[model samples]
Target: MAETLLQDPRTKYPVPPFPKQHQDVPGRQSAMQPVPDCGEDSYVGSGKLTGRRAVITGGDSGIGRAVAIAYAREGADVLISYLDEHDDAESTAQIVRDAGRRCVLVSGDIQEQVHCQAIVQRAVDELGGVDILVNNAAFQMSHKDLQDFSAQELERTFRTNVFATFFLTQAAAPHMAPGSSVINTASINADKPNATLVAYAATKGALQNLTGGLAQLLAEKGIRVNCVAPGPVWTPLIPSTMDAEKASKFGEQVPFKRPAQPAELAAAYVMLASEGASYMSGATVAVTGGVPLI
Candidate 1:
């Protein structure tokens, strides 16, 4: 018998400081030096979410894209919400359609409450109804010094990262029946704040709190609200926001010495959305690769 060689995810090597690269805020996947792995080739769905509908914000690329692909493969219709990343969004849509599922692309700034509400409405109208809601979209900027952070940036960060979560959930809640799940993308920053990501960190803290409170509020209604707190994940946000030097060392601080590939997160999102997590709510699943959320 021949032995099969399998990649050991635990020993995946760290990415060295990448070649200096930058994109205007909201980066494109095509421009990335090493394209992110969104489980396009690797993940094989087991029909965990068959006959379901999911609405994922930031589904254009990175973890959002990974989750969208996973959900589609699991037999769910997906509505992907993105901010002006038309090409990336189309690419993701194609992947979902390729998976034998329906994919709807809604492009707009999630910062607006109206836009967030519209995301849920479109899902109901198009995908039928929302059974899974993943608030996976976020915005961040690196500012080492407090003074360097602008007021405009502060407001934008909160609006996009925090407010949108509330808006979308409020819009989606009434339609969600018992056994539906809501998964928000929190960050390790909620536990260990990075000095440069103050605003983004603050918003993550807020999200975790919202996740907990809503879990309690929705318990009787049978909706589960949870979150994933990831540490340094290699995504377009790194190169687009950090200077080359910083981006290269992005995942070094973790004991694993490398950021998680986007594909690595797909299982956690799927598990939370599936029926297996029916009894789980208000939990923060830390997928931080070796980083402690303590």
Candidate 2:
């Protein structure tokens, strides 16, 4: 019998010290160094999500983009909500379309309750109905001191990370029938908070709590709610939010000694949205590269 080949996780993707780089807020995936691998050509689908309609925020890049690609390949039509990353969103849309799935693009700030509600409505109006909601959008900034964080910055982080999740869930829940899934993109910071990322960590903690509560609340309705707590992932958010030095050495603290490519995070989202996870809810699936989540 022939033995199957195995790939080592540590050596699967690029490692640090990566080239120091930076981008403004809501970074473009096209501009990242080495760019993130979103499984554009790698993921294979088996119709796990056939006939399902999905709404994914921040679908233009990073983990969201990877999920969009995976979901589309899995036979799900997707609606991507982004904050003015036109080029990135269009690229993702094209990938989905090429996969023979309808990809609707909506660009705006999810921080607003109205906008979050609008995203769900758009999904219902265009994609038929919402069967999966991936609350993958987020905002963060590193500050050496709490005092260094302006009130506006703090508010923006919470509004973008926490408030938007709440708004989108509330709006989408009505449109979602039984067997639907709500997947939130929490972070390892929820369990192991980073001092420099105090506000972002807080929001992630809130997401975990929200996931647990919503899972129980929606159980009777047959809608599962869960979260993915990823460690350092090589996404546009890294260079745009962290300092150059930190960005260069990103994910070094993890046992893997390297950040995860966005593609690495897609499978979790796909499983959670699939029937395989029908009995799983309120669970925080940690993809922390061997970093245990307390």
Candidate 3:
């Protein structure tokens, strides 16, 4: 994996790629012509989450995959809740195991409360307890006009984006003690506001709020809550979720003229989850490629 010019196939390092990557469906990470660079070799870990357990939704690919690797390196056993992306989930689990920690893959939709509860219980039963929870799974579709967005699309987007966050956090929060962390994946579009992804962007706004309220609600328990608002990132979501033209021009408008790699965003997750960020909560880390206006 290291022999070739390890890049995200978008642009220069630390800046992200311009053209988006991935498909609109459950895109296969390994099938990507030029896979996203997840900063495995460069990611350094401290014993922050040693002996801890983490439950990360969407841990199968993209930023979730990178975060799982980082968490394993930092000494946390991870349980992943994801859609049926079997190969990607297995591959990520292998990386976590190789990093010398246990990786439990929990496949299901967070749209269901039952599934959310079961996922938390499985993490506790399999990994001992849940110390960290990251609500990172999401889905989106593009539409030129508001009327073009079907009711089904709006419901599905919100169900996965905002509703899932609330349900999973509700389940995991009880199991988490002091020093536990919850990181929600917000989006730059929440602040910047994109016209194309109206419903999806709106859901992100709710997620940002969820982060804030959860931080306060969990403060009494000594658990910290925060968010990572990434800009145009080159992840499987791009290819699978965007139209062909949109996918090809994924990150053209960013000041850096590129999209962020899933690996680049992984560090933010590690920072928030680890003890080094003990005092931080309810804050958003803007990882957009210098979207100056946003």
Candidate 4:
């Protein structure tokens, strides 16, 4: 038998205690000190999602971008929805096109129900139909005190992180046929709440609950709903939302000394979106670097 090569997870990627850095909200992955490895070169697909059409929110960078690349290589045409990150979005689109799949870009605020609906409509009109819907876009800000959170800030966080998922799913459901799948990008914060990220954590908890309820609701239609709960991942969101000191030390708390690269999380999203997950609905697959979610 040919020997299988195994790489140790702890040292597979760069370890933290990284240099201090920062970017504005909805950070650009290109500017990070160690730009996240979103599997631009390494992921090799086996046609798990052949001929499928997918819509990915926040597909410009981070986990979303990684999933888009994987799906494209796996023979799926993708529609990427993001905020005003044209450069990043273009880069992702190019990669998808390089994989010989169609890539459509939609830029707007998902907090608006109309925009969410439009995103789905665009996919149906452009990609032919939507077989996979990935609600991966989110907003987060670090605040030490709950009192520091303002009414507008709280509303924006919930609207972007929680409400948009419902709006997008509701819009896409009618257009999605049986055997379609919906994958929500949840977080470890849902189980082990982060004091400084109370609002974001609360939104993720709601997503997990929403996943279970929606899974049951959609089961009758042969649609599966699931979520991926990730721990510390080295994405632009860390340097942008966290203090420089905190960002430098990100992921040290996990059992794996370093944070996961966006590439590391792509497989989970692909698995949930593929037909193999036919029996896997309402499942919360934790990719938390050894952190138990219970």
lDDT of 1 by residue, 236-276 (tens): 88888888788767887777767888999999999999989
Q: After superposition, which runs of candidate 2 have C-alpha atoms over 4 Å from their true positions? A: 1-3
Q: Give the distance in Å from residue 184's predicted Cα in candidate 1 to where it truly belongs.
A: 0.2
User: TM-score of predicted model 4?
Assistant: 0.98
Instruction: Please write out the lDDT profile of model 4 over residues 23-116, one tens digit for every residue.
Output: 8998999999899999999999999999999999999999999999999999999999999989999999999999999999999999999999
lDDT of 3 by residue, 181-290 (tens): 99999999889889999998999999998899989999999999999999988778878877766776777788777777788898899889988899999999999877
Which has the better lDDT: candidate 1, or candidate 2? 2
Candidates' C-alpha lDDT: 0.92, 0.95, 0.86, 0.95
Q: Considering lDDT, which of the candidate structures 1 and 4 is the better prediction for this target? A: 4
Global fold similarity of model 3 (TM-score):
0.92
Clashing pairs for predicted structure model 1, backbone only: 17-248
Model 4, position 209, has a per-residue lDDT of 97
Between candidates 2 and 3, the TM-score winner: 2
Q: How many backbone clashes does candidate 3 have?
A: 12
For residues 165-229, what per-residue lDDT tens digits would candidate 2 score against the true structure?
99999999998899999999999999999999999999999999999999999998899999999
Q: RMSD, each candidate, Å?
A: 1.3, 0.8, 3.9, 1.0
Q: Is candidate 1 or candidate 2 better by TM-score?
A: 2
